[model samples]
Target: MEEETDTEEEKLLKRQRRERKELQAKIQGMKNAVPKNDKKRRKQLTEDVARLEAEMDERHQQEVEHLRLEISKQVEVESLANGIGKLECEDGEKTAQHSRPTKAQKRRDKKAALEKEREERIAEAEIENLSGVRHLENQKLGHVLAGRGLQIKQIPSDGHCMYRAVEDQLKERGSMLTLAQLRSQTAQYMQGHVDDFLPFLITPSTGDVYTPEEFEKYCDDIVNTPAWGGQLELRALSHILQTPIEVVQADSSPIVVGEEYSSKPVILVYMRHAYGLGEHYNSVEELKDRTTEIG
Candidate 1:
């Protein structure tokens, strides 16, 4: 009967601990979900969370008492069984000696102790640490962008069942912006500079050179990203950011370099004005430094 009571108490304590652990995990999840800005809502959630934790601790304390009772019951059972002759050896020898714990068992116990201490230390540190609180910076940044009306509802930019994002700024604020305006805005947005990236202007027409920055941005954003092939030796003539002046054919055609020609590499800048300026630039650096204002 005592053994049975001990078993029941042990089981009950185990169940109580399990329930407390689950409550702890749940409270943690709710804390994560509640935003810092929503003070009233956060306060309510926090109070409820606190209540849950208090209840869990209360239950756990009760479980500890139950566990103590269980141990006592087990001890009593062992004493009663020892009182019975059936438990004793018929041919009694000297009591077997208890060997010291193995090195592995000792190490495992030490590891467990250390882990418990570390967890306690972390919890204490969390109490002292204000910066451990996550303000959800990424989501805040997203909201900032959204507030600026940068969010354009994705719509199909093509016949395929796919949606392409047109910047809200582009559709509304920049609706009347020219190529120059577009280029300047992108440069300002990205690098706080007044440069432009015009990727479709120069080709076998202007006979101008390319800049390294222009080449990289074109590859990163357009050629590698959009995967537009066949247009080899793409050059930028513009000094601005996004709206780079690129070298396209006379009719703004995509030029296939090797298949189009071999030895005589005829490079063209898109604008006739750019071709007019070609005689002005002696080298690549000169072209990059040259900012033209067409009369």
Candidate 2:
């Protein structure tokens, strides 16, 4: 539907462009056709040129108005769709409360947990200026982590930060993993547990929820390309590694993937202002020992 609408809009725009060009050419021709000494003819030519210009301007204004209306209509549709989706989710949650031990119930629970984290567990919207960390603020957060016997291990600010951070965390625990392998594993995990991840899989670019097919392509991208990881990927990694992944931010409470008493040690990551200008990731860990001093 969106593609069809875009195609129609493009056709209209192309028609308008052609019309404007013709009007310009016609006006220029009329002006050039009149000789300087032919005053009466020149006056008539000028009027004709002005009339053509007026038509062009009117067409331009109409096109602009049409585009504005189209944009307004799209916004309304998107708003309505979002509202309906929210209501459906609410209704599903109400039903899930009384649901049996079926697959639907499990899906409902996963959806609820994921939505809660996406909406309320993290305060990521206000931390958009992630060009780099503020020294004073980073120091404060670091001190807090240090008090908890942890410190940040800086990772490269490249687009692969998230993958690198996860790899580093795994390596520290005696596993030599590469970013590519981790990405592949994460993609595989998400594919195998589609029901668990599907409800939470939204396209960041479109702000639309993903269909299973769309998600499959997303999984392929994760496996075949070096895409930056986000919350969904983090959760997928936790399942893939069978370890609880904990993400601690400066402002929000830590997000945990599994129970605190789980036998597998928790993997910790510290998110700084690491991803506004460009997305990146960093690992937070127990303080390193250097001559018995902590890093």
- Tell me the alpha-carbon RMSD of every candidate: 30.1, 28.4
What TM-score does model 2 achieve against the real structure?
A: 0.49
TM per prediction: 0.25, 0.49
Q: How many collisions per candidate?
A: 26, 0
* lDDT (tens digit, per residue) of candidate 2 on 197-276: 77655453464678878989989988886555666777777777777777666766776665444655555555533432
lDDT of 1: 0.37
Q: Which ten contiguous residues of candidate 2 have the minimum total lDDT?
A: 122-131
lDDT of 2 at 113: 84
Candidate 1 per-residue lDDT, tens place, 1-43, comes to: 1343233434554465576687788888898998989999897
Model 1 poorest 10 in a row by lDDT: 276-285
Question: TM-score: which candidate is best?
Answer: 2
92 in model 1: Cα distance from truth in Å? 12
CA deviation > 4 Å runs, candidate 1: 1-21, 86-295
> Each candidate: what lDDT?
0.37, 0.65
Error of 1 at 211 (Å): 78
Error of 2 at 126 (Å): 17
